[model samples]
Target: MVTPPSYESRQFERRPGIRPRQTLGRRLDAASRAALPAAIAVVLLLLLHAPLGLPAQPALLLGAELACVFYWSLFLPRVMPSPVVFVLGLLVDLLGTGPLGLSVVLLLIAHVAGIAWRQALMRQGALVIWLVFAGVAALCCLIEWLATMLLEWRLLPPGSAALQFGFALGEYLVLSGPFAWCMRVVARPHG
Candidate 1:
């Protein structure tokens, strides 16, 4: 007759002499990964309050846009949670003129799209990534314009939307490389 192994014997045999030190190291690594999004959020909030203005510009570059896209793509499955996206959008709406809740809704849509397409973009190069950022930025602009018109019942002229979209596309393209590099640096495994 064949005898079954004891529960204690089986458990010990599955993982022998795995020290608590190894477990602690893993926990620390996980904590480090989890901290990244919070760090990004704090930095973004600081930037929101910073005086990094471009004089004589009607439409200025906001760090929030870059922060949103970068954090969403880099930490899609973890850090950039839906609530964060919605809150970020609401914060942007409060800071800007386009109707309240408009930015929040637009951001939520963009974040959803980013999450859906993340895997496909991950394998591409920087230039392709920049192109993706441009597309997303354009979509954000479109959504904002649509939401404003729908809520306020004032049709924003096509020219205005085009101008705004152009400016955002340029801004996102300019910032994409730096943001992607920063995310890569942060995601690197520490020795």
Candidate 2:
């Protein structure tokens, strides 16, 4: 019996352990992978303003986005550009009744600080990373408090500003795991 010509085609060849190809619609391309961090930033920003009925929800979400921005900016600068950070910060300012341009400046500074310390952070352990984050969050909170005071022409209680710093640090700890996982697994467009 002669095999049909179609039967002898390359498609007939079977590779062991490899499944048939499927649609790539579910897979993100390199550009999309690079944009994932920024996309996450947007989502977190939106959630920041959501009325979740929880006290300090806004602070928590802001902390989350700040952590997201810092991590991606440090590890994947292309994924989290300065403009995206600026926009998120702007949104925070717009959505809240805080001082205008305050978050924008803080976020931009955080993004820059992450970039500036990227190389050094890359070689460090989790402790060092956490310490550096603590410093950055502290500086940002301090700036925010000072800016608010200057804009309002009076001293406001530092409690909330200090709370913001605390939230940022806590969120960073919570988010670092997922961030690492995404960089190692989900963001790999090549595979």
Candidate 3:
């Protein structure tokens, strides 16, 4: 009589000594992956706020922050937690000499918006993602402009915020590919 296949003989069975838990090196790798977003934020802030002469410095800094925040929030929200976002925004505010909490509020709103949009898109193509990012970036710029005007109690020049938004869109488009590739490597589940 034919007997049932033994568990050890099954094709899908795991090999001996191979566990679901990763080795020490892999665990360290995963840890670094998790910390990458925060590290990148710190580095970006440092570079932007450095004393080097740069054109449109404030706008460039804001654009970089927005791109980094949006990319991480959309793809790897867990890696880019709210607290990290808050701290990054706070750093930008302190560095850029903007009103306290302005960047924080803007970043938090962007993070939420990104999460919502990512859910809707569900890993859709890059074009759709970029289109949605444009809308979100525009909204973020508006909110920031309104907040600045309200806090400072003065009307700002027209088209300033638009300029910032344009810079931010440029940053987003340029950085998305590199960030996406990094996320693919870092966010992958390790065995």
Candidate 4:
């Protein structure tokens, strides 16, 4: 009769590390999954550029930025990545009359900041998320104002940047709960 393996032998058995093994099929699947959100963001950005004259006025630009931030940071941070963020910002810069790298830098900064804060924010609920979004919007507006001042050598009128920033803040405030709920729905582990 054979004896059972000892506990020490079982304990020493080689086990895989935390990282999943990469395979061609898995990589392709990930790429495929990522395409949908990226394409949606691009199409939405283009539609925003279409000049349909949404009665909200100049806040439209702020709305676009808010959507980008929410999509890239909170929604699909891993799939979209930094290069996509930079490119999106570049497109915004080109579409708007702003300084060349303004949007690019702003988007990058915001994305990185969001990732850095993500862990702590994840522990909180919808209200905290809304507050974080407001903080991010305010920071982005400040950065945009500084860029404009440095590049254009002029300050925006009192209500100018504030209005735009308020629009962004409001967008986030209005949508944060729904977006968070959707994120949970989409992120549920499937088999």
Against the unseen true structure, what C-alpha lDDT does each candidate score? 0.60, 0.80, 0.81, 0.66
lDDT of 3 by residue, 84-158 (tens): 999999988887777888899888887887777877776688888888888888888898889889988999975
RMSD of each: 8.4, 10.5, 8.2, 9.0
TM-score of each: 0.66, 0.81, 0.83, 0.72
- Model 3 earns a TM-score of 0.83
Instruction: Determine which window of 10 residues in candidate 2 has minimal summed lDDT.
Output: 6-15
Q: Of 1 and 3, which scores higher on lDDT?
A: 3
Per-residue lDDT of candidate 2, residues 1-191 (tens digit): 98454222335454456655545754336567777787777777777677778788866765777788888888877668788888888888888777888888888878998999998998999989889888988898899789878988998999988898899999999889988888888774333
lDDT by residue for model 4 over 1-191, one digit each (tens)?
A: 99675343355444445646679996776566555445655665677678798765555565555555654476446655788877878888888778888888877776787677877876888677767777777888887777778777877675667877888877666555554554455422121
Model 4 alpha-carbon drift over 4 Å, by segment = 1-29, 56-58, 174-191
lDDT at position 46, candidate 4: 79
The reply for model 1, stretches above 4 Å from the true place, is 1-58, 61-67, 74-76
Separately for all candidates shown, the number of backbone clashes (residues 3 or more apart, or on different chains) is: 0, 0, 0, 0
Instruction: Return whichever of 1 and 2 wins on lDDT.
Output: 2
